[model samples]
Target: MASSPLKTICIYGAGALGGAIAAKLATGLGEQVTVSVVARGAHLEAIRAQGLRLWEAGADRPLVARMTATDNAAELPPQDLVITGLKGHQLTAAAPGIAGLLHSGTRVAMILNGVPWWYFHRDRQSGHAERQIEELDPNGELWRRIGPERVIGCVAYQGAEVINPGEVELSNNGRFILGEPSGENSVDIEAIATLLREAGVNISISPRIRDEIWSKLMGNAAFNPISALTRALMSDIMQNPALAAMVGDVMNEVKAVAESLGARIAISVEERLERSRQIGPVRTSTLQDLLAGKPLEITPLVGAVVSLAKLTGISTPTSATILALVTQLDRENMRAAE
Candidate 1:
């Protein structure tokens, strides 16, 4: 069968990950693809005034492409693919508008952290089908607006940050794992994966993406919240025996919950901890959220595990304690800001 021509790709958030993807697409795919970004505030303004700039290693490059950007989805044409690069909480806020940007065949790839809202639905044998994660989606907004079928799970393994408006600092890692909800290989999946690969991303189609999701979630579940609450970097968290053990406890609990759901983690807890240590002096997204005074993704990142533990008849005492401490700190931070 002949492959369908590539359609325009719109990256919704245009943050660090989004910007890197956009730059790579614009550079590699060129006119073969139309790239647009949806963003707001000073960043959006800067991108509009001056083209998006991407800096990697020691080189800076200004990508010259006529990309569309807007806060409103109504300002653009119906998208064939919409890559959501927003944080978990940001997705809920932008759900309604995002729904308006999609047509029937549109695929919405979620590239956020923690467990996705559609995690349970993708597991057929699991009893919790179409389960709504209230801590993440709250009020069933994302569940209703963006159906699970339209979702393509993406796990980003990159460390990029926006240094200033319109410019992003690219990190050493730039790989993305893509998978379908049904875990089947399809034309649409191949098309998107090929486009991403052509755009300079190390893209792979996984038969068991849920397993990969949980594996990554294990690290985020422990490192992110703990880092935020303690205001420590990854190296410090891994070096301190006590903190590392606390992280280990959280991971062990999460591993139980994941196994209960039939998602077997390939990596051991000790190996995963060593991997974190290898990442060196990296600041987790949770710590970044805390420092930026943005809302921390505690509910989806940690609370969802607690909810899953309840569903699976498992206990997660350490995770529960950490969740409590982080929740308190987030609330206090919000209160002080208010």
Candidate 2:
């Protein structure tokens, strides 16, 4: 007899990224894989009541998967893979609740932006190994609860958002890079990659996932905070030579830190900035968070780099200054919200 296929995979934070992945899996993988989503508030109700609505490629479509939406995680079964699409800060809030959903062999793929909580674990030569990012992790709850060994790093390049409750709009780019902490090609990693690739995501199993993480981080560290602080789109920020130059300085400092950690970025600062420019006018998620009145994820995105610089004996003056400014900005924003 044939073996039973992978039964259940949950997209824990079923926002834009989660919705897209769920819809694709429900469509392509069908009975071979079971897709469930975990969400809250109107989004959760919408998915439960009306199924998930996806808008992509200039067409509106809906896929009704065997989804479960609950603010609680104990209600769900142990999952084969739990794809976490929450922002770094949001993960902290939900970590305890979601801990029960993981079995011993479960792979928790973190699809967040900036530096993940597990960054230093995979980085053998990084001086910051075993050092916790207090600003991001806060109380070391995530590092303690989840542990780095269970993590599979994912760098999401897709741009998407929820157009309405239970509905998502895919803007462009649906690529996801996956790798293990030890950079080995394992069966579990490939299985997860296969599911994602079948779901229309450009999934690549990278040998040097740290390089990809830093490459993406180079753009995020500059563009995200700058966009949030200035309230400008990508094209507008890149067009202003002075502002663009300021971003370049931050990138230079970050590159130095990466090199010191033994992960040298192949692209120059200017080339990376140009790549952002070519993406045209786009509002980063940090800017979106500010507008949405959500907490700014500055610590993981910027502060982690600054902390890593200190560990590696490198100076990140530019990143340090920008981080300070963004922290103040986030504080004021939080006060206003209160």
Candidate 3:
């Protein structure tokens, strides 16, 4: 059979992660693939004016790339692949616009953290079959609009930050773990993986994406909130005796919930904390948001886990207590902005 024609790919929410991916696709693959970026505000304006810039340490100059950039989803053609780099809290508001860019065959790869909204969808034994996580999705709007069939679960490890309007500085050259929602194989997902790998992204396919998700969540559920509350880096948070003990409590609770849902996290709490310490001082995304006065992603990151714990009859005292404080902090920050 002949090879399929080149397909169009769009990176919605062209912030740090999406901008880096867009720059790679537009420059790395060039004419082999059509790439578009969806961005807004000053970043979109900057991209339109001078293209996207990537700053790397020890580089002679910044890497620059150009492609179709737009804020309105209606202005762009339907995409064969849409990778959403938006934070968990931004997904619902952007869902309709994302839906507008999808053709019937379009596949959406969600590169985000914490407990996903689709956690209960494919796990029949998780007590809630096909039930939407209201804490994450809020009335099933995203579930009804995007549909789980179009989803490709992902765990993104690469770290990047927007230094300015159109410039992104990559902090880590990490891999993206991709999987289908049903935990099965498909040609469409392979095509997506190939496209990303060709664009210079380290990509891997996982049979149990949820297991990987839970494993990653073990860190997020413990570290992110602690970072935000104490305004401390991962190293300091994990090294502290009291904080480390709290993290252990939170991780155990989250682990029980994950095991109840048939997803096993092999890594021990101490191992996860030790690995984090080895990475040196690192500020989490939740802490960054709190500092920037942006809305914290409470629902998916911490609240959803607590919700799952309750549904499964497991107690998450440490996680719940931290979630309450951080959530209150978020509300106060939002109110102050208003």
Quote model 2's TM-score. Answer: 0.94
Q: Write the per-residue lDDT of candidate 1 for residues 267-328, one digit (tens) a residue.
A: 99988887777877878878987987877888778988998899899999999998899999
98-206 per-residue lDDT for model 3 (tens digits): 9998898998899889888776667654666677788788888779888888899999887677889999887767788998877778888888787778878899998
The lowest-lDDT stretch of 10 consecutive residues in candidate 2 is 1-10
TM-score of each: 0.95, 0.94, 0.95
In model 2, how large is the Cα lDDT of residue 298? 89
Candidate 2 residue lDDT tens string, 162-219: 7788888877857899988778898888888877776677899987788888888888
Between prediction 1 and prediction 2, which has the larger TM-score? 1
> Candidate 1: which stretches are off by over 4 Å?
1-4, 57-66
**Model 3 segments more than 4 A misplaced:** 1-6, 56-60, 124-127
lDDT of each structure?
0.83, 0.82, 0.85
Off by over 4 Å in 2: 1-5, 60-66
Distance from true location, Cα of 253 in model 3, Å = 1.7
